[model samples]
Target: MRDRPQSDTRERIITAADRLFREIGYQKTTVADIARTLGMSPANVYRFFSSKKAINEAVTARCTAEIRMRLEAVAASGRPAAERMRALLLTAHQSVLELGVTDAKMQEMIAVAMAESWGVIRAHIEEVDAIITRVLRDGVASGEFVPSDPEVTGPCIRAAMMRFCHPGLLTQCHDIPRPTVEQQADFILSALGHHARS
Candidate 1:
């Protein structure tokens, strides 16, 4: 079909851009570099992505997709809210750490995302919040947690876990070693009114 090549070309562009970002950092990698790597013209790259920012957004979305899928799986599971919430938090933290964002070049890309293409990062955070909200609502319905406003708690919980979840902060705070991921997840669960079994 005609659509398959276009999809493949777009994926190829995203793949090349991600590689360059890992090799040379996001601030330094150019569309021309991506095109050169693909043996395609800059105009062809533009046809798929209108600008370098577009390419950067695509690459970022691709990188974060795996983490999102992991979180989504935990959210959609049929476990009790308290257990699901704990698993979701743990999954979120572990998945982000596994993403290798602390690497110098990956950190550079994250820094650029924070500065230039914040919408992409914000979308990811929003997705996380939505998953948390879904779990919290189920927790309330199941009587596993107290009735509370998920909208308020969702982002609050996410902010509380930012040190573990945020790529940039994760690297900076890894050395302090005070509140481990397990402790934080338990703290957040307790704060949500989950009483651990004896």
Candidate 2:
């Protein structure tokens, strides 16, 4: 019989690693732990991943991929661009919120991912920015937004919504109740030169 596919083994490693990260967190979880979960030796795990950090990066990528899929559907929807944009921003905030930032174990995992797996996180940010840019361009084309440079405007929207999107900020700012994600989305929509229906 043919040996197991390398990609299958790699995905198994990532799936096991993600479950472990959620259970024990990034700092406490180790290669040995992941290997044992897979009923393999640590040396076997090493054959697929160079280090725990690499495994963590894969796990981070998987989590962010969840958000990306939702954002993509929002961006591609047939609704007016401004409305889609509002939905997109709120969707992003909700997606990150669903990642269990309140759980101490998941919180520690997020903190470590932000600190150690920054490149993976940064790529996720860049992809999100691209999605925002797409909506900006769509709004401009439809006269729903003022003509502006999307490259600059995209990141600005991301920065403006950082409180909702960032893991720590969601927890830290939860007590301050003035501006909900809906309010922020409206503010962003207005800033895009959109006038909501009366």
lDDT values, one for every candidate: 0.89, 0.91
Q: Which digits, one per residue and each the tens of the lDDT, describe model 2 over residues 37-57? A: 999999999998999988888
Q: CA shift at 151, candidate 2, in angstroms?
A: 1.3
Candidate 1 stretches with Cα past 4 Å from truth are: 1-3
Deviation from native of the Cα of residue 58 in model 1, angstroms: 1.0
Question: What's the distance in Å from true for residue 104, model 1?
Answer: 0.8
User: What clash pairs does model 1 have?
Assistant: none
Q: How big is the positional error of residue 87 in model 1, measured in Å on the Cα after superposition?
A: 1.1
Per-residue accuracy of model 1 over 1-198 as CA lDDT, tens digit each:
576998999999999998899999887888999999999999999999999888888888987787889989999988788889999999998888877888999998878777888888889989889999999999988888888899999999999999998898998998998899988999998888996655
Clashes of 2: 0
